[model samples]
Target: MRKKRGIVKRRETGIKYEISRKNLHYEKALDEIIRIFETENYRDRTINDYRRNWREFFKIIGKENVFDVTREDFRKYIRQRMQMDGLAAGTVNIRLGGVKSIFSRLVKEGILTENPGKDIPKLRTDEKPIFAFSDRQLKRLFSIIDKTSVAGYRDYVAMITMLYCGLRANEIENLEISDIDFDNSVIMLPGSKNKNRKIRAVPMNRKVREELRQLIIENQENFGEDVTHVFLTTFGEPIHHGLIRKRMHKYGKDAGLIDEARVSPHSLRHTFAIRYLKNGGDIRTLQMILGHSDITTTQVYLRYNNDDIIEQYNKATENDDLNL
Candidate 1:
């Protein structure tokens, strides 16, 4: 007869095991997950995030086994995360996605009988990411920099690269002199966030080309050697991200353009996309130039097509003899 408490089951094969209702399935599931990610060659950063999430989950489960974990555990995790200071809904969703991915991998590996995170829904929150700057704001930012100063020249170049070419912060920072082709007026970004390898060509607008050319000339004349990047601090080092943001904010404040809005280096890329689309650039072309993996991603800029809306409105309201 099975005992009501402190029970141990022994098999004829001399194998003894304790079968508790606690969740043990998660243990095998986590190991299988690591193997699956290793096989798939997920990015290092992604794998690190999974490991961190697994740690948090293991801590929460304590002595509980994986199979015994319920949807409630995940819900409670969400609540706990929400209670944390400075936790954004979007960020939470990403972590939740990592958790879900672990279970999914477990299911695929035949480790877990079922996926617990599958049924878990995302939390709702009202926070839209603030992106890009307006054309007027971009102009104001440029106006505050002194064209002759090293910092000013670096910033101007950075702005042009970010705004006109739509390069990411890292891409701009990593850019080498060899990345640019002065004759071709193009740049080759080896790879980026989406891991897409392609070259980007920006037909340097007259103003931007002139600014770059002048900077190059001045550097050669003053330093007796050519600089590596289109932008560099006075110390010939790459500008720090925080310094760039600070300078942008300072300029924004100086231009009296401060507002209840969030802005960053990414704003240049966003503003570029909008202006390009509004000027009738094709989605496919924009995708190639911006190194976008999908056309849908570039479509985010299409949402800001105020020019098209106004043209349509004008067309709808136009009447030659309305006054008569």
Candidate 2:
């Protein structure tokens, strides 16, 4: 049997423990998030981007307690970004991921029992299509590069390496001169530089091999054997990913190729993969060369439009005989 005592009075402000939980008032919530990200040793760029996105989200929703934040709040932030700012779906989606990751961390730490942004679907993004440059466009792009000078030669080699090796922008930036094995004609990418944190070797064809050799000779003669990076800037400093992108854009603009296709490092990589597959390279082998951690990611390159499908179908069935 339970004993009944005098009725307890409730505070008009809030419940007892709720006072302590008020620290999750979004301002402190962001502070806790920064600490957690730092403790996890996230990259500076990643941390900065996450912080920016959080501020953007809170600015949109007008900063309430994290405890009071609901899924609809997340939806409202996304809607405002799409409607008012006219941001691309992909851009908004990336920022949404940044915002959601904070809620996830809070849930993991027992600060919140449920993640508010857990089931928020990404915005549909079918406005523009990604594509690779045709052989003629690539040839025109190559012809425009001024390979006589050091900077021009550097750009030329960089573009060719991406076409032949199918490397990402960061991978190109991180390529060390020592990673190139002239004897075996292989370029070894260390785990630290790879997105998946896995070591992989990319084989060099005869063309890639000879071009890399020339670049090395020029690099050594000018900067000496002490310089470790495979590519350098016009000022003899380390290459940056932004500079590479801008150079690709410049090359595209100069060659009048930007009108037909998007010009970037990834496009060169896509060109490499499509050519590799069209030349009869198997999916499994292509996966290894591109350093993809999952086969499904590599399989996306296998997708073809209706026109391409019909062409390939006619070619394949054209030779087959139904003799049975």
User: Looking at candidate 2, what is the lDDT of residue 134?
Assistant: 81
Clashes found in each candidate (C-alpha, N, C closer than 3 A)? 8, 0
Judging by lDDT against the true structure, name the best candidate: 2
Residue-wise C-alpha lDDT for candidate 2, range 194-298, written one tens digit per residue: 777789999998988898889878888888878888889766667976778899899999999888879999999988888888878989999999999999888
TM-score each candidate.
0.74, 0.85
Reference-based lDDT, residue 41, model 2: 74
Over 157-208, each residue of candidate 1 has an lDDT whose tens digit, in order, gives 7778778877777676667666666776767665543346455555566666
lDDT score of residue 27 within candidate 1: 48
RMSD to the true structure for each prediction, in A, is 6.1, 6.4
Model 2 stretches with alpha carbons more than 4 Å out? 1-21, 125-128, 305-310, 313-324
Model 2: worst 10 consecutive residues (lDDT sum): 8-17
